[model samples]
Target: MSADQRKSPTEPQRGNRPPAHGRRRILITGASSGLGAQLARIWADDGRDLALCARRLPELERLRDELLDRHPHSVVHVYQLDVSDAEATERVVERAVVDLGGLDRVVAGAGIGMGARVGSGHADVNRRVLTTNVIGTWNTAEAAIRHFWDRQDGHLVIISSMAALRGFGGAMAAYSTSKAAIATLGESLRSSLARRPITVSTIFPGNIDTAINAGNPDKKWSVPLEVGTAQLAAAIEAEPASAYVPRRPWAYVAPIMRVAPLSVVRRLVG
Candidate 1:
């Protein structure tokens, strides 16, 4: 709720967490590609054990083998998870926690960027986006935070977006809406759990040419995949209530987007 809750370039606030390079157990949803996959690589290289989940079991296995091949000592388990299925999400998360012996962090990173114009008669696309991005995230959060609640210790990170600072129209409508909801959800969780050791963080990533953002209008300015996720891993390590990946411009740009005139917004984003 306070302005300081959003991290600044220097001295970003952190929570009770493992040491910067400590080896710990982490679980990540949507680990098949893009941000999730890259984050796995970054952390694996740091010697952390991981539980990687996504709809694509094959890709998960491939990533698991690759990480294991590179870091022979790290333990990586892959689970086929479709976070939209609440029951399955709960089951798989519990199982993954069991497999990993325990969980130290969970990243609810599963999401889709599909959308349709409000009046375009493509209700199905809009529904899919809301269900996958919003509901799917909620399901993952529900299961993960429940586990953390039991121990009164853990970190939950939601991958939000800079798009959340505004309500985009056209193909970005539902995606932006979902990200806005995620930001608010992370803030609410952080507030509710303030008295506990559990740390809830929200990461607002800038444009990257990931599968979910094929239609991003700002794609040309996208940070390279490895560069963006490396920044993401650093921000997550800090465990801020909220953060912008590659904080230089976004740490400044996000605030302006929140209050800028719609005309200016249209010219900049649309």
Candidate 2:
């Protein structure tokens, strides 16, 4: 069967369970750049508390200052984190829970895509991509879900990609593989937590002008950071099982990507 034709896990309809309001405190990793930074800005503007973590201290500090200046009522905490470090991720998350009193939501957006092409004669580059994107995402998810289990309430948001819908070649090889792994992880969590209070949302975003794709040659249907992120924020608020942001184009394009001729897929995605 094609990727789009597979049956979803057995569970009630995702829409019937709307997220409970008052997700006042949130934790976001990879807050140093790209989509992570934009999500922080939107949440802070809502006057919600935030715990932003990333490897770049300066960027996190700058984001914290920007948020405080625009919304002084919002409380923003910054942390220096390398999500690939499992122990450090656990510690940072624990401290964040203490700092924020409790975390109502956690966005596992920490990842890297180094554009490592297949057969590049160097495995190290692809290794780094997998370690950071797959293992790093796992660290972040485990740390956050630990708290969620203890508190018996939380939201886990896994930021996947449209590339995950099918395998790819060239620069996207490892990155696509990593995303596919985490998408399954998110689906598994959703099934495991079906009876619990915790909610797991998997996001498949299509081409939102970020650093990850700034160097692509044929940039088709790409939106600016703000416009894309606004759609992402809305989807996150809805807390669906899975969604493709800028939903119309993606909702239509995704199915075609799965079933289209292989040559057509190469031209469209490449």
lDDT of 2 at 165: 84
RMSD of 1: 9.5
- Report every candidate's CA lDDT: 0.83, 0.84
Error of 1 at 207 (Å): 0.7
Q: What are the per-residue Cα lDDT tens digits for candidate 1 across 50-117?
A: 88999999899789778766755456778899999999999988987777777899999999887889
lDDT of 2 by residue, 1-270 (tens): 222212111221122222245787899999988999999988777767788999999989888777766755456778899999999999999988887788999999988877567778867888888988889889988998899999999999999998888887788899889899999999999999999999999999988999998998776789999999999999999999999987968878889898988678777866
Number of clashes in every candidate structure? 0, 0
Q: In model 1, what is the error at residue 197, expressed in angstroms?
A: 0.7
Clash pairs, model 2 backbone:
none
